[model samples]
Target chain A: MKALALGILAALILLTAPGSQALAAEASEAPGAKPLAVGTAFPDVPLIGPVSPELADSLGIPQNGPTPIAKVKAEALIVEIFSMYCPFCQRDTPTVNELAALIDKRGLAGRVKIIGIGAGNSDTEVDIFRKKFKVPFALFSDATFAVHSAVGQVGTPYYYVLKKTPQGFTIVAAHLGLIHSPADFLADVVAKAGL
Target chain B: MRRIVPLLTLAALLWIAPAMAADPIPGGLAGNIYPVPTLPPTDSQLAVAVGSPMPDFDLPTITGGRVKLSDYLGKKNLVITFVPAAWTPVCSGQWPGYNIARDIFEDNDAALIGITLDNIPTLYAWTRQMGDLWFPVASDFWPHGGLAQKLGILRSDGVSERALFLVDKKGVIRFIDVHDINARPDLGPLLEAMAKVHAEK
Candidate 1:
């Protein structure tokens, strides 16, 4: 009876917490569309760019062409959906860079690749974001919101871990909002992608 | 009873954690942005023209300092932006987007001044969600859109139109974009104009 009372009390505190309530309110306001679920086939997103020589070598794609997501040479891929205007994305820039460094530290640089899609941002906007944050990954513009719509219009700073298979790319994990711990997030990505 | 004490304590921490992390700005994804209805495209007429001397004004900033258009005349080029109001949709997203474009202004040796009809306290509360902005935000509140009225972008609803003015170091307006009241002005063109102005100098 005492344990039951404690559980109920704990549950009550969580339920009534101002932060939780605010989160719930915000969640409701978010689009009802669900993100690409894990175990689902990832779409072949066409990314446009004046792809830098370094990014081309990293993804093993041509420097001047629209590269499809599935065509990128990688055993596993981390897709970060962000917006140049998103404060959370701005705050998470360093952490996401740290995640990339962590990937290199784990010797997963060749096998695991990361890229960012600037939702609803033009090439100029993406360029500004890239330069401002000194982002170390290849970022593509979704100026027309085509990629955003393709990815279900989920909120900014959304992450997707996908594994390449003979069939296609399959979603391994999908996360929304700020990544609290880059190390843990990379660990999860590594484990889920089996890399 | 001892076990219950720790459990309650843990519950209390859980309750306080989110509150501590709560952002003062209300909305979630991109700071405290509230979704507002799409307004009419262009609401007001442009009173000032390109090549005309921009009407000078002394306005109070959110930081409690006063800024005069004349103060920047001989020193730096100016890009003055006027938004309709605070806490609304396009207005909220517009300034934060400029946060990343600081280098563009700096590259051209230009200073950006964001203006809104909202008073200092309201602007302070609304801008807190934008984190650290690279420019000063001024409130044109005393005569309520006095500066806006001088520039002739004040709307019928007692707010200014969403507009931008690129003023050269000579205090002569080089470009004027009385943009649609409902949408954000594109940064690319503004940057291009700033570059052109710098080239002329």
Candidate 2:
């Protein structure tokens, strides 16, 4: 009789608790919150660049091929997924241009294709910003945002450096920032994929 | 010489006191909502204070027009509000709050602009989708949260964290309220700020 009473008391407490549903919702959400940080072999799903259409129309890139830039290309690719009007990216570009200069100074320019992909905008907007920021690299247009969708990273100026190895192209590092400094950024990138 | 000295001292005191006036810095970032002593002592977290200068911006508007941080710096003051994405619930409630205050903003020679990462097409569709018609909803779409990111208000993932900023015509920020994804900016505080801006200086 005592045990049955305690069980009944427990059931009543659970049923009548204030904000219980919200607590349960939080409990259910915490674990599901994706913590896929650096080194998580970025999903293999095909992604659309912000400017892929312009490239396809202009250069016949991928030539209707499955992967753009390929799952395997260089030692590593420094990809900047951006939208033309992203305010943080505007601030970040000057910083990114500095890093690009350092990479050029280090003779890693072509080897490290510092690329930009436009998210859901016309090719022209991306081009205008590229000129405004003087970011020498061509911005890829992701007409569908498939790439942004696959990575589940939606922030502009979100950067990903993927290194191709005998295994496959895997993400070395990714950051969304007003980066602390250019050297610190390079250090993190170099540490992961080697200078 | 002695009488001249007191007059000089009084003039100096008058000039120095207002600059010493401590602007109330807001606290309660991350979750709690209280006023902190000053602008964040550290930049570790992506938060801005109420009276700090609103981070600057120059971007293309939805209708092929250009918008600058300075153009709308109203003759009196300005309010800049950022919403996470269009078509969300709390934003639905929050944006309309700005709309309802439109008349008061105009009367005081103040202006309000709502900014977000959603493109103009999406912004237009969503506003109409939700039947929001009062204030201008500016798009931060192409550059993808760039303005918010500079302000340290963009989330690590993609969507923006809801925020509202009141900037004076002098380009000095007078009010800032950045909320977590779920929290909403209380319209009462904004109404109070508007009142203060209109109050005779």
Candidate 3:
């Protein structure tokens, strides 16, 4: 009798558990949540790690695998959400490379850093993109979409500039589509980032 | 009271679980359904067949100017990709996937030509959002799916099948794929097909 009663209890829990219910609530809430806009403090979102080798080499940062966003040692950071299969991302490659070049040319490399999160792409796909475009910045794959969820990303080729402040970081700017001109993009970033 | 409360909470969880599965992605398109079409279009009279010479047509392009199939025959290979329509889920992302694979087509000395029943303006606007497609996008819109109908892949829905036909240097149909309208064909098969045709030369 006790065994039968225990089996019934287990079945009830599997069929109607609060833990699973809570997870579903969270999933529903994610899509409806207010997006982080400019001037809003950047949330302490967790980052997927083992940063790409090329990016680590470019930034001269030692690869201390699986680092957090808070641990990134930079005055300001530009986060680009992209995907390998996204044609817009492919088309936007040269412009992004230009931004990286401008940062280096203007000597902003020491203060400003750019990193890309490949939304819904695998590491191999991200590697293909990095190689194809010869990207000079760090790019990470967020195949599980954790990073995308953190940023509330709607599509690829999204941009967000985060300025480091004493109290962590604040989003300085956000753009939805292509940055038509590299010079203008740099100027806007410099002005908004207050660098 | 506490024992009864557990049962009540369980009932609530059961009531809400299924509804929660359809949560929307924030700032994303709503009512986005990707039901894979089960019934493949019945095999109709196909226009071009294997070992047959592809018929030439000067169809209007999305980026202006017309594309003539015979023009590329002597100089380069050609791959014509025909998707069903605009704004559909799979169709929206399909061409963009090809946009990134420009090198694959270039290496094989082939040019990709995307076609659809939609008019030039529709293709222009839709492809513009797809970002700088390196290939020419054509419209088989004039005769209301005339080109696709000639190829015999046009479905009864007045749209082309998600098809691909690889024509070699002699303008011969070397490979063809009348892919499932509901599915995105893998790129590997296309690449392999390109290699096979390249070897024949």
Best by DockQ: 1
Q: Model 3 over residues B87-174: C-alpha lDDT tens digits?
A: 6666776787677777878888888899999999988877775657789999999889888877898888788888889999998998
Model 1 lDDT per residue over A45-95, tens place: 888776789988989888865788888989999999987877778878898
How high is the DockQ of candidate 2?
0.01
Model 2: per-residue Cα lDDT over B1-201, one tens digit each: 645554555556545534433224211111111222222212224646665776788766555676687786656587888877765544544553344345667876787788888888877765653334466668877678878877787766566767777788877777777765664545556756767877746
> What TM-scores do the predictions have?
0.83, 0.40, 0.55
Question: In order of the candidates, what TM-score does chain B achieve?
Answer: 0.86, 0.70, 0.79
* Chain A TM-score values for every predicted structure, listed in order: 0.84, 0.66, 0.76
Instruction: Report lDDT (Cα) of residue B25, candidate 1.
Output: 53
Residues A26-97, model 3: lDDT tens digits: 111112334578998877665554565666665555564445565666778888888776665777889999
Error of 2 at B199 (Å): 50
lDDT leader: 1
The clash count for each model shown is 0, 26, 1
Misplaced by over 4 Å in model 3 are: A1-34, A37-52, A59-75, A83-95, A106-111, A118-134, A140-150, A163-173, A178-195, B1-75, B86-103, B120-134, B146-156, B163-201
**lDDT tens digits, residue span B103-194, model 1:** 88999999999999999999988888678898999999989889999999988888898999999999999988888887666677888899
lDDT value, candidate 3, whole model: 0.73
